[model samples]
Target: MIALGVWQLQRKGEKEALLALYERNRAMSSLATYPELPPVPDELLFRKSSVVCLDPVRWDPRSGTDVKGRSGFRMIADCRTGAEGPGVLVDVGISDDFTPPAWTGGIVQGTVVPGPEQPTLVERLTGRAVAARPMLVADQPVAGLRQSAIPSGADVPNNHLAYAVQWFLFALAALTIYIFAVRRRLRQ
Candidate 1:
């Protein structure tokens, strides 16, 4: 149990460092250079950029939410830096209505975010696959909808310290119980 506690403490440090890196990335301004369609590194997760929408925007009703906790949906569509193949998915903005925006294909600016894991509930609700991973969080409003806030790593809770304390307490309780049992046996 002591060893487990120590491990959790180490994990806490790692999580803190990761959170700091995320903050730094979020603070950096949008990169003037956009990389070709490929795997983006962790360092570029929150980097901002402009992308031209190549395909029609599709709504992902499953993962939509507003800053005010209102029900909404994000517009998802394939986009590229220029006329090219292998465009990436972009999350345009959140809208309360289901109507598609008139500006379907155009240059949109936004920050990049890691694509969410496949949400089974969303897929079931929309009857379609969730938007591709590593989608963009648009900085501009679309179809009279407001842009959702880009998630910062700081919002992630670091509870490893609390977990470590719980483990140590459990070990201490077990040790006290054993000592009491030994004393009673000796007295008897």
Candidate 2:
């Protein structure tokens, strides 16, 4: 448990560094370059860009919340950009419907955000290197949907310091109990 607490503290430091990177990069002006393919670097997150989605291949409905925290579904679409490399995943919009939105394809301006995690443990073990592509969160919603929440790095949690403190308290309590028990044993 004590080791676990220490590990969590280490993880907290790493998380803080990642958050710092997000804050620094997010503040920069929008990039002059827009990707034709994906696997965008973590450094590019939150920078505005325009994506011209030529063809929307598939739509994925994910349970998500709006900027106001209202419960809904985000319609993420796999787009065929007519580029040579991998296709892009664009978050079309949010809606109460689980069904795919009626949007076909168009140009949209939004921030470059992290994409969904992919390639499960089995895939990793199998050596399937399916890289998770970064997604474009559209600034405007599709005709029948609402704009999705602009994700922030603040959404990630860092409770490691608190966990370390709790572990230290537990160790102290155990030591105190042991000392008292030893004293009673000696008296008896």
RMSD, every candidate, angstroms: 5.8, 3.4
* Tens-digit lDDT string for candidate 2 (67-151): 7888899999988887666677888888898888777799878878878756688898989857667888888888898889988
lDDT of each: 0.72, 0.82
The prediction achieving the highest TM-score against the true structure is 2
Instruction: Give the backbone clash total of model 2.
Output: 0
